[model samples]
Target chain A: MAEMAASGESPEILFWVGCAGSFDDRYKAVTQAFVKILNKVGVSFAVLGPEEACTGDPARRAGNEFLFQMQAVANIQVMNGYNVKKVVTACPHCFNTIKNEYPALGGEYEVIHHSQFLQQLINEGKVALKGGGEFKGKKITFHDSCYLGRANDVYEAPREVIKALDVELVEMKRCRTKGLCCGAGGAQMFKEPEEGKKDINIERTEEALSTGASAIAVGCPFCLTMMSDGVKNKEREHDVKVYDLAEMIAKDMGI
Target chain B: MSILPQLIFLLVFAVAGYILYKRVSYLRRNIFLGHKEDRNDMKEQRWKTMVLVALGQKKMFKRLGPAFLHLLIYVAFIVINLEVLEFIIDGLSGQHRIFAPFLGGVYAVAMNIFEFLAIAVLVSCFAFLIRRNIMKVDRLAMKELKGWPALDANLILIIEIVLMFAILTMNATDQILAERGVDKYLAVEGLFFSGLIQPLFQGMSEGALIFLERFAWWFHIVGILAFAIYVTYSKHLHIFLAFPNTWYSNLQPKGEMKNMSEVTNEVNMMLGIQTETSNDPPAEIGRFGAKDVNDLSWVNIMNAYSCTECGRCTAECPANITGKKLSPRKIMMDVRDRAEEVGKSIDSGGPGLEDGKSLLGDYTTKEEINACTSCNACVEACPVNIDPLSIILQMRRYVAMEESGSPAQWNAMFQNMETSFSPWKFAPTDRFNWADQLKNEEAK
Candidate 1:
C-alpha cells in the first residue's frame, strides 16, 4: 500500500467493512486504526459507502444466478470506477467472491483478506508495535472462516498475526481444514433458522469454549457475531470474549 | 378380363412405395437422423458405431441365439419384398409367370427358399409379439409395447407364412388343372397335378382352367399389395426411423448435456419470482430461460421424435431398474408430446429452443436430477445414444445459479465463499491456519 502510494499516482487500499464488520464497533474501531496507520505512512484508502449493500453472495448460493451476476457486476463497476485495484476486507466471503467469482463475470482485481494484508505489514515491520504491551499471559483461540481458509486457501496469515501479538494461539478439535460451520452462511442471516438437530452456532461456540481460552479471536464479521452470541448463550460470557482479529492486533500494537 | 384383381395389385404396391418415402423423410428431418456430428475424438467410435451398427445389424446377434432369430427375420423381410413386387407386376400385366430376365428357373428356386425362410421368420416375429405383449417381459419396457398392436405383428407374420402357403396351393391347383388339359405349363411340361385334373377337365372345359389360373394369380398379387400398405403405417416404421437415428445420434456423454448458462441478474432476484402482478422493471426484461414446451431446445424435441421405442435406453438406466419414478424413455416421449402441444401455441415461423419452456418440472423433477449420480451409463447403453445427463445437470445449474433455491447449507457455504474466499463459513483473520502445519517445512 505504501509503495503504491509513494509512486506519483494515487493508490488506495479500499477497506471494505462488509456487513459483518459494520455491526461490530470494536472491529470497526480496530480497522479504522489500521486505516490511520496507512494514512500516517502517506498511503491513501477509502471505506465503502456506509450503506454499501451486499455483493449478492447469498443470492448466488441460492441458485439466484441472475442476482449474483447483477450484484457482482455492479459492485465491480463501483470499485473500478474509483480506479482502485487493491482491496482489503474483514469478511472472507466478500474477499473471495471479489477476488474469484468476480473474475468469472469479468471483474478482476487484487483482493486481500485483512488478516493476510495485516500480517504482511507486520512481517515488513512497516507498522509500529508497542514494546511494553506483550500478550505474555493471555491464551487466545483462533477460528478459521470458510471464505479465508477454504475459499481463498489462506490458512497461515491469521495465526501469524496472533503470534506477532505474542498470544498463545490454542485450537479447538474442529480447527483448520475440518472446521464446522457457524450456521450463519447462505444468507441465513436474513432468513429465520430452520429446526436443525442443534443450533449450529451453539455447537461451534461450545467447541471454542472447550479450548479454555481467555478470548475467541476471529477474522470474519459473521463468525464474530455467531461466536460472541455462542459465548453469551453458553453462559461463558465471563470466561471467553469474541474479539475480531483486527481488534486484537490493533490493541496488542497499543494503538 | 377381370379388372378387380389387377386394380388391387397396382393400388397396394403404389401405397407401399409412398409410405417408404414419407417415413424416410420424417425420420431424417425431424429426428436429426442423418446429421453429420462434429465432435471431439471418436474416429473408431464413428467407424464401429456409425457404420457398423446400422449396416452390420450387430445388435441383432449380440446374443447368438436371439440374434439368429432377428437376423433371419430381418433378412427374410428384405428378400420377400422382392417377390412382392414381382407378384404385383405379374398379376396386373396379364402374365402367367413372374418375369425374370435370366433365370425363370432360378426365380422358382428362390421362391422355394423364400417360402421355407418365411415360415422361420413368421415364427420368430410371433414369439417376439408374445414375449412383448402377452408375457410382458421386463426387457422390452424401455420400448413402448403399447400402441404396438401385437395383433398387427401377428397379422404380418400370418400373411407372410400364409402367402407362401397360398403360392404352394395355387401351384398345386394349377398342376391339377394342367393334367386335365385345362391349362399349359409352357415351361415345365407334364407336371403331376395337371394330369389328375385332365379327366375332370375333359368334362368341364378349357375356359374354366384358364379362369382358375387368372384367379390364383390375382389373389397372390392383391394379398401382397394390401400387406405392403399396412406395413408402412406400422411400427415397422422403425424399418425407416432406426437407420438415421442410429447414424445421427448425440455424440456427447449424458453428463455433459450442453445448454447456455442462465445468468440471472441479482437486482431482478431481490424482486423475487416474476408473476402477472410483476410491474415491469425500468430496464429491458429477462424472462426464465425456458417458460414452456416451446421454450425447450429443438434437440430435446428431436430426441423424442427419433425414439424407435427399442427400450434399450430404459433397460440400461439404473434409475428405472431401481424402481425410481424416472424413465429416460418416458421423459423423451413426454418432451415430444409437450413440445408438440406447446408448438401449437407458437407462431408458424417456429420459435428457437430458448424460447420454449422446459418439461423438466413435469417429468424429471429436481429431486430426480439431484438423485442421479451423473453416471453416463444411460448414454453409453443407448442404442441411439441420447445424452440425458447433460439435460439433467443443465437444469440443476439453472436452478442453482438462477433460482437461488438450494439447500441452506450450500447457501451458507456460498456466502462463506463470497466473503472469506472459501466455502466453509469462518473468520477471515483465521484463513491462514491450514498453513500453520506447513510453516516449519517452508522455513527449511
Candidate 2:
C-alpha cells in the first residue's frame, strides 16, 4: 500500500492475507501459491504488509463482542485509510467476517473468496491449465467449508474450479448444505475439545477418506489444518494428501 | 327434548374453546417474555421460505422413507380437517350431511377422499409407532426421549389413530343406517374404507345403530376439540408454529453472526472515531448475552417451541455423533422447558428469573454449549428453521463476557488475540514474512 501510494498508483484489489495465511507455517504456502497465481494473471493488487490486523473471527465466535468490535474497528481504520475497495482471501473465516461483518463498522468493499477469484480468472481465460496435469482424470474429493458453503452459499465455485482441472470429483455422504464441520470452528481449534468418544475432526476426516479419493481439496485454512491433522491421526498422510483450492489451481497452472 | 343434544354439544364446545383460548394466551405471554428481534424485513423472501420449508415439507425430505410417511400423516392432518369442518357445522345446526345436500355428488367424493386420508393416517401412524418402538430408529430412540417426550410422541400417534377410527366408525355406522332407510342418515355409497367395515354394522338393530352412530359422532367432535387443546402442550405444536417460525427465519447468510451494535458504539467511542449516523441516544449495556430465557430474543424463544424433537438436528450434530454432551435438539428442548418454567413461576407470583436456576447450568451445561462447532448442520437440518446454534452462541457470549467462565485454553487464546491480533503468540510484523519466500522464489 505504501509503495502504491508513493508511486501515485492504485491497485485493482487488496490481498487479505489472513492470520493463518500469514502466520501458520502450513497455510503460508497456500498464501504464496495464491500470490503466484495473482502475479501470473497480471492482477494488480496491494497487501497491507505490516498494517493489517486480525479480523477477530475467533473473538466474535468465542462470544467476546467487546474484543471482536475492538479488532474490527482497528482493521477497518487501516483499510479505510488505504481506500481499499476490493478484497480477496483464502481463509473462509476471514472471508466471512470481513465480507459480512465489516460493513457495519464503516468499512464496505466487494469481497470474494479465492475459489471464486480463481473461477473468474479461469472463466476470463486468464489462468490456463495443462490438459494432462497430475490431477487430470484422478478422483479428488472437495470438502465443503461451513463458512463458504452453507454460510454464504458459495458451493459451486470451488467445485467448478476443481472440475476445470479435468478431474473427477467425488462427494462424501455428507456434503453441500448438510456438510459437517472439521471441529475447528467456533474457536474449537485453539482449545481442547470437550470429552467425547471421538474427536469431530476424525469423524469428518473418516467420511472424507471413505470416499476413496486419493486427494482432498478444501477451501478454508481452518478446515485445511483440521483435515490435515485428521489425516495424520489416521496415519494415512502417505496415502492421501490435502491441498487448498488455490494450491491446486496454482499447481495445475504451473505457476 | 330434541334440543337436548344441541344444548349439551354447545356446553362441551364452549368449555373446549375456553381451554384452548387460555392455552394460546399462555403461550403468547411466555413467548413474548424474551427481548424483541426485528425479522420483518424481506417480506417476499420470508413468504417464499415459509412456502418451501413449512408448507412444502422440503427439509424433511432429506430422509426419504420417514419423509414419505410423514407426508402421508401431514396430508391426512390437512385433508381430514376439512371433514371436521362438516362435523362442526352438523353439531351446531342439528343437521346431518348439510354440505351433502348442497354439493350433491361433491360431498361423497370429498368424504371418500377423507376416508382414504384417514386410512393413510392410520397406516402412517402405525408405521411411525413401529419405527419408534420395534424398529428403534436411532434418532427416535435416543435417551433424550426416554420418558415424557417418548410417551408424548407415541400418545400423539395413538390419538390420531383413535381419531381416524372414530371418523371411520361414524361413517360406517351411518352408511349402514342409511341402508336401512333411517331418517336423518345420508344414503351414501361407494365409500372405500368405510365400505370394508360396513358389514360389521349390518346385524345391528336400528336403535342400536342409532345409538352407536350418535356416540361416534359425539366422540369424534369432542375428541377433535380435545386434540386441539392437547397439541398446544405437546411437541405437535409444530403444526401451527412451523409456519410463523419459518417466516421469521434468519435470512442472512448462515455464516454471519449478528454484530452487537452497543459494543460497536463503545469501541468506536474508545477509538475516537467520528461517524455521521450517531443520532441515536447512547445505548445501555444490557446483559452481554443471554443468561436466561428473557435475555434471548423472542424469535429464539419461539424456535424452542417450534421444534418437534424429531432428532434430525441431534442426529446430524457432529458433537452428538462423536458422543459429546451437546445435542442441538436437546438445547432447543431445554430452552423451551426453561421458558415454561420461568413463565409458570411468574404466573404464580414466584421469583421468576430470580428463582436461582438458569438455562446455562440447570438446564444446559457449560459442556454442551462448549462442544458446539457452530457447523450449522442442525440449523440446516431443521424443517422449520429452528436455530439452536444462535441460542448456544448467545449463552457462550454470556459465559465469556459476563462471567469470564470460558475454559483455560480459550482464555489463553483470547489473550493471544487481544495482544498479538492472532489467536497465537506471533508478532504482527511477521504477518508478511510468508511473502518473503515468495519474493525469493520470484527472483529465481
**Best prediction by lDDT:** 2
lDDT computed for candidate 1: 0.58
Model 2, B172-274: lDDT tens digits are: 9999988888988988758889999988989989999899889888888898899999999999999999999999999998888998887876788888987
Candidate 1 lDDT tens digits, B64-151: 6556777777787788778766665666775555554456677557755665566677678777667666787685533434554345
CAPRI classification of candidate 1: incorrect
- List residue ranges in candidate 2 displaced over 4 A: B276-281
Model 1 regions more than 4 Å off: A1-255, B2-4, B13-48, B59-65, B141-236, B252-255, B259-299, B339-370, B390-444
Residue B407, candidate 1: alpha-carbon lDDT: 61
Q: Could you tell me the C-alpha RMSD of candidate 2 in Å? A: 1.2
Which tens-of-lDDT digit does each residue in A1-255 have in candidate 1? 223334655556777656445434444554565555565455566565432445666554444555466566666656665667788887776786677666665567888988988888889887666634546558888887766664455779999888887667898876664455565554444444543345667777888888888898888777887788888898888867887777766666665
> For candidate 2, what is the lDDT?
0.91
Maximum-TM-score candidate = 2
Output the lDDT of residue B234, model 2: 91
lDDT of model 1, residue B290: 33
